[model samples]
Target: METFLSNLSLGFSVALGLQNLGLAFLGCLVGTLIGVLPGVGPVATIAMLLPITFSLDPTGSLIMLAGIYYGAQYGGSTTAILVNIPGEATSVVTAIDGHEMAKKGRAGAALAVAALGSFFAGSVATLVIAALGAPLTRVALMFGATEYFSLMIMGLVLAVVLAGGSVLKAVAMILVGILLSTVGTDLETGDERMTFGLIFLSDGIDFAVLAMGIFGVAEIMRNLAQPESRDVVRKPIGRLLPNREELRQSWAPVLRGTLMGSILGILPGNGAVLAPFASYAMEKKLAKDPSRFGKGAIEGVAGPESANNAGAQTSFIPLLTLGIPGNAVMALMVGAMTIQGIIPGPQVMTGNPSLFWGMIASMWVGNLMLLVINLPMVGLWVRLLKVPYRLMFPAILAFCCIGIYSINSLPTDVMLIGLFGLVGYLLIKCGFEPAPLLLGFVLGKLMEENMRRALILSRGSLSTFITEPISAGLLIVSAVLLVAAIIPNVRKGRDEMFVE
Candidate 1:
């Protein structure tokens, strides 16, 4: 405890320096802006801005980039809540209830809840990083390919819980997503499985393109088709802050999300992406009225948003302690550190205590900056709803196009957005939820990669997943969760049949 305190004090001292604070603030500001823009994710932003950080000290550069990472977590929900377009993958579930809340004239409350939840989660995760970084790093190291594959299985099973209706539809969407994830060239053999001879598809679909097209474009089309429904957003703006009751309801979910995210973020291979989904599933399962989900449940927004931010912060654990980058953004961080003559991993703590601890300390400062930056802007974001849909949607569509195009300078991606938009609209018409598909798409590639690796290591032995202790345990849990999710639907069907 004494040593931890001393290191923490040292971290704050370095992070509190004027230069570091300025850089951190700048990073957060830039990050939030990019995050609010659909399809402009932190990975692209960080990659582009990385060159500019060459001249700064290692600690300062990392502090700034780290700010962009978690700061984006705060801002990602803006579009999700107000416009139904999730600016980040982590914000996807946020859109489910958040946009619903917006339509009900609770935009202000939803945004406030998201910002506050994120800030609280970030603060707690930062402390976890400082106090438990070493032990957690060891825990992360224990996850091998077999274990990771089993964990992904569990995550996919949990995705079944995301649907508010029709378990079959949700399962179907997940299968479609997994199929789409297989479209790119096979990594080992260089064989294109489902590209259909299209060069653009050879690289596989861009997630931002998919997300923008499916949510933003489809939503715009839906609004245009039903002009009367557009007026729902123009409802009187209520309290700009969450009421006392709102706070009371949000606190438990925030705490639960923080704990779940902190634990998951320690896993390798971008386990953070699963945090919000897991939190959402947990929240829905625990809700007094589960039917209130997807329509506009405050706990849905609060829990998932908290989990998203907490996971974003804690993902740095593997990078800092094990020299492993958990995601693309962390990979860029590795490059940044390497360029600064700093080798990541266990040696960094002993070699450059100030830099390591300072980066850890800056996370807290960065979260505070984000809260200060986001909370005041909630009103401005809510005001955007007052604009006529006729004028606003065109701007949103144009922005989506520009953002998708900017991702790879590919006009085809812009075209793909249109294609996915139609697909999204069709899905909506058919009563399918897109959330399960999105999660499945995101996890599918990682799952395949890990599964293949595990198989190769075990000489194609199918029993390796069962023989590995951690892998076996995860599979067991997945089985239990799957059964639990399915039994409810079956029971409901039986009751309805009897009623009929």
Candidate 2:
């Protein structure tokens, strides 16, 4: 306890320095801006800005990047509340009640609750990281290839559960993501799998290109296709903060979300994505007025928003401590760290306590900066809704094209984005989620590496996967989940999720 406290104090000292604070503030400001804009999310924005981090001090660079990540989580709710569209997938539940609240002229209140809940959740999650990082690292390093693969398999199954659409469609989308990841040269054989003899295809799809194509461009296309009606700005703005009764109602949900996020974020795979759904489900089950959920319940916004941010923050611990990224953004973070000659493993703390703990403490600073930046700017964001779609669409298109092309200076990437944009739109039309597809794509590279290493070590013995207890148990769990997902009862629920 004493050592942890000392480290935490050291972390805060570093984070509070003027330069770090300024960078944190800058990151949150940019994060919230892009986050508030329709069709923009953190991953795309982060990838676009990644090159800038290369020139920064590692601590400041990471602090800024981490801020942008969680800061976007907070910013996403603003758009979700003011508009029916959710900026983040985790904010879907928030959109349920939050947009309704906007329609009911309580947009201000909903936005306030989201920001406050996220800030509170982030603060608590940081403490959880301080207390749990070392222990979780120990736990994560125990797994081998079979275990990792099974864990990923289980995550894929759960992804369908969280995918909010047809399980079959979700599975299909995941298969597509895996297929996309396989486009690069085959690792085992020195040959290309699906590169079509094009030099550009040899490196596979970049996450930046894939994400911008699917989420950013595809989202813009969807918005343009649907004619706008019922201008949401029609609602009158309410008070900026929740009332006492509202506070009482939200506290329980906040606590529940924080705990749920802490647990889910520790798991590998797309567990972070599932965190918000779990919190929303729990809140709905625990609510006194369940029917109020779809009709604009405060708990709907409070719980899931808090959960997403907390999950986003806690997801970092695994990436930093074990070199295993729990989500796409973490994977990107790992990439950034690697470019700077930092290897993520048990040695990270021992080798670079300043970077590790500094990041921990910086998360708190980032969260604080988000609230400071967002609260006063709530009215401005609300006003941004007044911007005409005709103007916004062109701007969004410009951003997407510029962002995608900046990656490799390849018009081929732009073409790829167009192709994936069509693919993503088709998946949506068919009731599939693009999020799980991303999870599959992000993990595929690492999964292939681990699988090959384990195979080589075992002299090509396939039995190696099931021979170890941890590996065996994970495979067993995945098998059970796969079987369970096909059960009549489960299938019925899955089919109903088509609206997602």
Candidate 3:
């Protein structure tokens, strides 16, 4: 206890420094703006900011980056609620009811719920990180390659549960995502899997390109194809904050979502993405008016919005404590640490308390900073809904192209993005959801690596995956989830979970 207290004190001292505080504010501000912008997610934003972290104190840099991450998520719910366009895949569940509320001219109520819920979640998740950091790292360290493989398998199956369309179509899209992931050079044999002899295929498709093409460019194509007469009601957006009645209905959801988000956020692979959806599903199951879920339940916005923020905040646990990045933003963090000559791993706390604790303290401060920036800026965000599509699309597309090209500096990436844009459009036309495909692609590379590593470690013995304790546990849970996802009776109730 003494040791922990001493470290916490030191962390607080460093984090409260004026420079660190300012950076935290900067990150939150930048993050919110980007989050409100369509297609430019925290991952791409963090990647773009990687070069800028080189000169700062580790505490300040990490705090700012983490701020960007959670802040973007906060802003994401706004767009999801107001415009029906999810700021990122994580906000899809939020859009289900949030946008419905907006359509009903309760955009202000939805925004208030999303923002406040996120703030509460961010606060609780920060505490969760502080309390559970060591134990979670201990749990994570027990996972070997075989266990990781099983975990990835579980995540892939869960992706299907969240697909939200035809099951067959969702599975097909997942397969396509996996195949796309295989386009890069094979690690074991140094041979291409599906590169089609194209030089761009050597590195596979960057997630940014795939995501941008599918969501950003394809969305543009879609809007242009449809007649402009469809958009009739501009959300009236009466008030900026929720009334007392809404506050009463929301507190429980915020708490539940925060707890769920913190736990799920720390899981490897697509856990952070799953946090919001899981929270939304849980909220509906627990709601008094379950039928209001799709139509316009404030709890729907509150829970998922809180979950996404908490998940975003807590995702740093693995990256900071274990050197295992759960997502792209965490990966960039690892890179930033590496650039600073600080190797991130179990020993980081022992070797660099200032960095570790300062980072942790900065997260709490950053979350607070996000609330300050986001609440007042809600008006500015709503104004964005009035921007002309022609200007917005070009700007969004340009940012997407730049982000994709910077990953490998290849023109072929642009072409692949265009191709995926077309594919995404077709998928949209066919009523297939794009999120599960993105999730599948997100897990694909790691899934392949873990599978190969496990096989190699076990000398190609498949039984080793089940024979091990951690691996067996994950596989068993996966089996249970798959069964639940597939069973006909259960499917009728949670049908939203079992499709494309």
Candidate 4:
């Protein structure tokens, strides 16, 4: 208790410093702007801005970058609510009932609930990190290759559950993503597997390129094909504050979502991405009238938005505590830390206590800043939705192209975006979901690496994964989940639960 309070005191002192606070505020502002603009995610934004961090102190730079991450979560809900377009994967669940609420003339109310719920979640998650971060890091250090491999297996199975429709389709998409992940040279052997004489293929496809292509460019193409009337929301913006009954209904889901997100965010392999989806599933299950889902259910907006924000904040745990990147964004953050001459892992907490704690403290501050920025600016975002699709799409495309090209200054990357844009369009046309593919792509490389390491350590024995207790338990759960998903009666019941 003494150590916790002392560390927090040091954190507040550093985070409250004039320069760090200013940087945090600036990052929040910029992150919110990018989040409002579809296809321009925090990954691209942070990568673009990484060069600027070279000039600032390491602690301040990280504080700013961290601010951007959670701020984008807040801003993403705005676009999802007002425009029916989710700016980030985390906000995709938010778009379901959020847009429905907009159509029902409760756009302002939905946006307000999202922002407030996010603030509440962020505050609680920040505390979780502060109190449990070091101990969690200790726990993470105990994980070996076998344990990690099994954990990845579990994560992949959960990804399949995230799909709203056919589980078979989701599994196929994930397998395709794993195949795509294998395109680069074999890391251990240095032999190219799928390069096919193309040097760009040797390095594997960039996540930003793939994400921008599928989510951003593909979305643009789809919107362009739709009629203008179908794209715009014609409903009046209703009251910003929810009624007493609405608030009463939402608070429970918000609390539940915060707990769910905070716990999931600590796992490896981008577990945070699953939080909103899981929260949505839970809210749907618990609701008295499950039929209201996807049609202006305030709980849908409140729960997922809160979960999204909490997950985004806590996803930092693995990066800060163990030097492991849980997702693409954290992978970029690893690069940022490396460039700043700060080594990640347990030593960071011991060696630079202020830097570690300050970053954690800034998360709470950033969330507060987002609430201040988003509530009043809700009107501005709604007006952006009023912009015609023709104009908005061009801007989205331009920004995507710029963000992709800026990664390596290569036109090949932009071309790849175009290629994947077409692929994404076709997949959607065929009724396949893109989110599962992304999850697979993100985890595939890590799973392969861990599996190889575990096998090597066990002298090529596959049983090593099941021999370890933690690994065994996780794998067993995954097996049970797979079986349940496959069983006809269980599958039918699961399908019925999600029916809208």
lDDT tens digits by residue: candidate 1, 321-389: 756555656756766786577866666777788998999999999999998999887666545434555
Top candidate by TM-score: 2
* TM-score to native of every candidate shown: 0.62, 0.83, 0.72, 0.75
User: Mind giving the per-residue lDDT tens digits that candidate 4 earns over 226-325?
Assistant: 6654244677778888999889989999999999999888765456778999999999999999999998999999999999888888888877876656
**Mind giving the per-residue lDDT tens digits that candidate 2 earns over 1-500?**
88888899889988999999999888888888767776667775665565566568888888888888888888788878887777776677788889988888888888888998899999999988888876766676676666666555665666655445466776887788778778878766878888888899898777667876776667766767777642455768788988998899888898899889878876655666688889999999987778988898999888988888889888887677766566667756765675466766656777788888888998988888888888887878767756666677777677677766765689988888788788777766767777767767766766677778888888998798889788788778777776776686576778889756
Task: Write down the lDDT of every candidate, Cα atoms only.
Answer: 0.80, 0.77, 0.75, 0.81
Instruction: Point to the candidate with the largest lDDT.
Output: 4
What is the C-alpha lDDT profile of model 3 across 1-500, one tens digit per residue? 77667877888898898998888889888888878766567765665565466667776788788888878887787778777778777899998998888888888888878877887887788777777766665676677778767866765666565445566676787788777778788877998877778776687766556766776667767766765322323758768788999899899999999888888888755678899989989999998779988998889988888888888878888666656566656656665675566766656776777878887877777777777777777778768655655666676567767766766678977787788889888898999876566656655666788888888999999999989988898788878876776685456758766654
TM-score of 4: 0.75
Worst 10 residues of 1 by lDDT: 227-236
Candidate numbers, best TM-score first, in rank order: 2, 4, 3, 1
lDDT of 3: 0.75
Error of 1 at 420 (Å): 1.4
lDDT for model 1, please: 0.80
Q: After the best TM-score superposition of candidate 1, give how far the Cα of residue 3 lies from its true spot, in angstroms.
A: 7.4
Candidate 2 wrong stretches, greater than 4 Å: 17-19, 47-62, 83-85, 95-109, 144-157, 186-189, 233-245, 264-301, 322-352, 489-500
Clash list (residue pairs), candidate 1: none
Query: Model 4, residue 55: what's the lDDT?
Result: 75
lDDT of model 3, residue 260: 89
The 10 consecutive residues of candidate 4 with the worst lDDT sum are 223-232
Model 4 lDDT vs. the true structure? 0.81
